[model samples]
Target: MTKDTPPPPANTEQMNSPSFKLAVQDRDFLLSEPMRGVRFMLEYSKAQILLQRAKIRSTIVVFGSARFREGGPNKEPFWYEEARRFGRIASQLGGALCAEGGNHYHVIATGGGPGAMEAACRGAREVGAPAIGFNITLPHEQQPNPYTTPELTFNFHYFAMRKMHLAMRTKALVVFPGGFGTMDELFEILTLRQTGKVQSLPIVLFDEGYWREIVNFDALVKHGVIDSADLALFRFADRAETAWEALIEQGLDVSVGENDEDLARDM
Candidate 1:
């Protein structure tokens, strides 16, 4: 009835009490940590979801130089036929595996660039099998091959994430002649295998003649640059069929839990 009570505190429900203000401030601080944690978890969850949804019953990470060009409509690079050959073989193998039903070869994938990458994807398409192209963003180099299967093509911004996706359920790897990028992917897998981060997967280096001569790896072995055991790190092949067979023979259709022991050794 009087102004002495200050109009019943002007409906304090809309205002924060001193203790409530302190509690709110404390919550703001506390929420920051878990908010970051939640973000981390969400990113990880997204990666996991991508991995899970990939139709990777059997996979081969095909690596090759992006410089080579198929004889467009008429003019072609020197390596065009060879690259196409490799692609055809990989496709055939993938198709055969798919024909067997369960756990059969599901997809053939490439770095999703032109040249050799395109060849592999094209090969898979030719054989009527699903193929995936893992394209990356680069400055003025590489584009997703046209042959990539409509259902499986994916582009990635993070190379590490892309690499992880490449190896997620991959059964094998086939590496053709390439520059630094090819070796980068190759060594990445080797490092993963050496440290037991990933189960053993067959790695095929295309072209024995070119590989042996062009690479100084043999010199390293001869000069005691590396241990003999390291020589067993990879196999060499000159033909697409050979690489395909190596992949099939290895039978990496199952996943093994991370081997802490192997990781420890690498460390």
Candidate 2:
């Protein structure tokens, strides 16, 4: 070897060494098939810890179409406004901001996307209550809306885990007119309730007309698929105030404040 070409440094021989790697820093290893269970546990524990630390006692899950926009197509504007109003009503009256030693209940929670989800989060923001957004990573990347509380927002990789978190702490559910994703969420909760897996809670569908047109709950009863008593599982409302009343009738424990005159007004 030429003297000008100095011998390679001995330390440079293992520059790509795996032995020096930090296990936590290895993204490839973490994403490998063997780590799937670990990933699931991480998803559950991370959100559990954050929510517990935030003192979120109970949640009102708002499930709806991400396609609806304010001032958009037929009934979209109405749906948007009603959903927003519901969020505010729930936050204001459901002990969310009551400060009972950080025991916040019935705080709004959403899918962390636009349309109805944004409206619900926006409503919670109107009352200055902390709202949660359980966002999922998608191929096109559904962005979380600005209304979600920054500290409470979470991103999830698995749909099952995300749904689990949504259902776990939910004290009630308000479902607006939506498509496939909305149906899936609605049914998930309904199934949980029907099977005695989840305790009964308020399930309010925002638009009665739209829901009747799309889903034939009556037909299910006629066909003997679901018992007539199952119809008692959900109720319908067209306005935000009416929805709030329905929730109260369904056994939601809401403390009425002296200055809570707005709850009496229909939106």
Q: Model 1 off-target regions past 4 Å? A: 1-54, 72-79, 94-106, 223-225, 248-267
For candidate 2, give the lDDT: 0.88
Please list all clashing residue pairs in model 2, or write none if there are none: none
Give the worst 10-residue stretch by lDDT in candidate 1.
254-263
1-267, model 2: which lDDT tens digit per residue?
Answer: 998999988977586676556878888888989999999999999998988788777788999999999989889999999999999998998878966455677889999999999999999999989899999999999999999999999999999999999988787899999999999999999998898887667899989999999999999999999999999999999999999899889987665343233322210
For 73-182, candidate 1 gives per-residue lDDT tens digits of 33235345555666677655443234333333535777788887888777777766667787887887556788987656666656766787677756578888778888
**Which window of 10 residues has the lowest lDDT sum in candidate 2?**
258-267
Clashes, model 2: 0
